[model samples]
Target: MIWQPLLLSLKLGVIVTAVMLVITLPLAALFTRVRRRWLALVESFATLPMVLPPTVVGFYLLIAFAPTSPWGAWLERTIGLRLAFSFPGIVLASCIASLPFMLQSLKSGMQGLDSRLWEASYSLGKGRVETLLRVILPNMRPALFSGMILTFAHTLGEFGVVLMVGGSIPGQTKTISVALFERVEALDFAVAHRYALVMVVISYTAVLALNLLQRVQLERRS
Candidate 1:
């Protein structure tokens, strides 16, 4: 059985989760601090992906990455990197598709932080970055783990967005989900079953870990 697709999926999930954590941590913190009337609009924009169809997101990403589009053209001309139909393209698409999972989880954690803790840190002359790293992050361990796991698992199982952006380039963009679809299309049910079973196990493991983590968190709180 071909293993490249599964490996690619794992690589994509790790990269996506790492990047998402870096980007989402600051964004979630910012979201929790904003008190303006337009905060709802900003939040809705961030959470839009959770409800939007994966195909719809993929369609827009495809257009944005097309060689003729200005963004795509600039990247190609400046960096000599074309995102469309490439591994990077799949990563970008998965990032967008799985963003809300991380954002919401992190945001909820950030919001739960006591305002007095921020005040105390500031009183001690700690910078926002220092406070976030030293205090906020330690307290946010559960949420961080949840977000990372969810993003990783979600990206691993992504079908529509990855397919639309990356196509089925072997050892490049053919992730496990896309590979499974191709196998089924080629009437290779036996191989498809193997892929499906693997995915099932992955999904079950993620769910079990999340539940255990939640139980631990609840016990600590109580």
Candidate 2:
């Protein structure tokens, strides 16, 4: 029983993290490079989820992804997909909720590097895309690694958005966090505790490992 939820959470986190990295890559690059007036607005939008309660975002997702809204209708029409009370809904919710961590990490990583490196690369004949792929991305390994682990852990613990958008469809959308709550609600405290303990240990171990890796990488760089 716990295995189902545990595996579901791992699946969700991995898929969400992959999509987030790809989708947010260009946005993060543009964000870190641009000298635009709207940078603050975009930054604020990404950071809003971090500050707001997950329930607040979930409530809006319910509305925004519901058939009543044109945006949702258009999405459904285009992709032949429904968003409400579905696994896709949970994925969408988690993606939105976890975006800031990835974006901030990537942005900070890009910004922290010496700008002259980009300039030098560009001057030497590397195109923007090439330089980004070969240089910027390599340099951002630490942030990218940390951000991925953080997002995975956060998604594993996500509750409110999953509850709001994804009904606990036992084999489909029942992530560990949601499953744990259901167990508690049914007064199955023992099982819930076990699930919780596993999650805590996994998360702690991942962060500790990532920190040590970051330290080693930093030392090598210095």
lDDT for each residue of candidate 2 in 79-110, tens digit (9 for 90 to 100): 98888878888999999999998888888889
**Where's the lowest-lDDT run of ten residues in candidate 2?**
163-172
TM-score of each: 0.97, 0.94
Q: Which candidate has the highest lDDT of all?
A: 1
lDDT (Cα, tens digit) per residue for candidate 1, span 130-169: 9989989898899999999999999999999998899989
Global lDDT of model 2: 0.88
Model 2, residue pairs in steric clash: none
| Model 1 misplaced regions, further than 4 Å | none
Error of 1 at 22 (Å): 0.4
